[model samples]
Target: MSLRIFEQRYTRMVKEACGSESGFVICMLNSQGNKDLNEHIYPIGTYVNVVDFNLLDDGLLGVTVEGVRCVRITNIKTEADGLRIGDCEMTAPWEFTATKELLYPMDKKLEEIFKRYPEVNSLYETTNFDDPIWVINRWLELLPVDAEKKQEFLQENDCSKIVQYLSGLVE
Candidate 1:
């Protein structure tokens, strides 16, 4: 299915498919094509869940969705809890499938980065973070975005790039 990138209008009652109670503010997008033609304009009060996340080029984020078919988002307005898409205001809950191969290397990379940057060791260890992807995203925010360094980071399926990037930072 073809991936469609649309500006999220914001969702209400955002929860993970695993059944989380409290909602989180998240933007949802889909990788597979929407065959139903749900229209592209989103109204307010749209509920949604994040099925998958992938880092895109030029600092864009990629998300894949599973449920709540036919999302049409025209313009999005930011609100206190979520954004209002057109006038719909809907909530969409979704599920994500995580693979071991994808996660294991990310953990390994973060650990290796910590070893190199001992100064940030505590930062790495003490935090009760959700997963290695969070750490990697954080690191990406602070570290310099050198092409060679970024290439080095993207070279491996794991965190070898993290070490390479961290070492560059310390140097």
Candidate 2:
């Protein structure tokens, strides 16, 4: 459970990635309902591996994906059918280290969230509450902030800023 970016062939892309045991990068749309998808999508994305996939009750595919790392997208091309393809370069995962005491509130709040909403809980096959990086990553995904603001975080080499940012919200 990491980022989920919507696309024209969203389900198809998931299936292709899952069937082939390949990973995919997810980026955000700059604006909604834009016909020019390649131009509209932001450059930063999260590279994730498909953890699980199943045929949903609605007959659509249900997929569980976990973020492996970050990436920067370039040279995007949209096919006639509207599938946007791009060249991606690996970006460093935000780096930070903190003691369990510092991350306790975030970990506990996330635990409460999972307990309160089974649907959200069901998304992850496993959770690492004791790991600060794991907690920080989940907070980034769950935050309701604007995508533009969240995008600013990708540029930060020190993830301690993220830890501070999230602590302010969680506390």
Candidate 3:
């Protein structure tokens, strides 16, 4: 599976396009060109959507944005890019940790997950990876998806929506 990196603002479009039922939201570092070398650069602090993500495993989202790449991951408590959740209309020099799951994709991991969290469906009912439903479902698990939550996702701007959805899950 090709990793599809996107802005948190585009959650609605990504969800609509991928039809994912759940997953964590990510912000890519816009590292296409060196716009300002003097500025502090961290891999996960980027608010602008542009960065390359390292998808080390197959069937996992390894996509990253193009320019000045950084990720405002929602799982951490750092105040990178204003508040972690809400409309992303501000800028900042901040930091947050990437989720262990985002760093690790599962095939074998699925077996471990099934063994551990039997209550949760880590794998879907269908194995059709290409199907939009299946594809989105995988994304949903990765990004944290739910109906009422996704509706909130559909109504917000990209950046804050990711933070909101992720923050909601942690809460």
Error at 150, model 2, angstroms: 1.3
lDDT of each: 0.42, 0.78, 0.37
For candidate 3, lDDT tens digit of each residue in 9-63?
3434344334442233344234442424312222233233323345454534454
Instruction: Give per-residue CA lDDT, model 1, range 49-157, as digits (tens).
Output: 4555565775554555432322223445545544433333332322213443444544566667777877766443254234544555456644667444443343344
Q: Write the per-residue lDDT of candidate 2 for residues 22-114, one digit (tens) a residue.
A: 888878777753546465777789888888767666665667787788889989887666677789999877666556788868899999998
* Rank by lDDT (best first): 2, 1, 3
Model 1, residue 152: distance off in Å is 20
Using TM-score as the measure, the top candidate is 2
Worst 10-residue lDDT window for candidate 1 reads 38-47
Quote the RMSD, in angstroms, for model 3: 16.9
* Total backbone collisions for each predicted model: 25, 0, 36
Distance from true position, residue 14, model 3, in Å? 21
- Where is model 3 poorest over a 10-residue stretch in terms of lDDT? 38-47
How much is the lDDT of residue 148 in candidate 2? 74
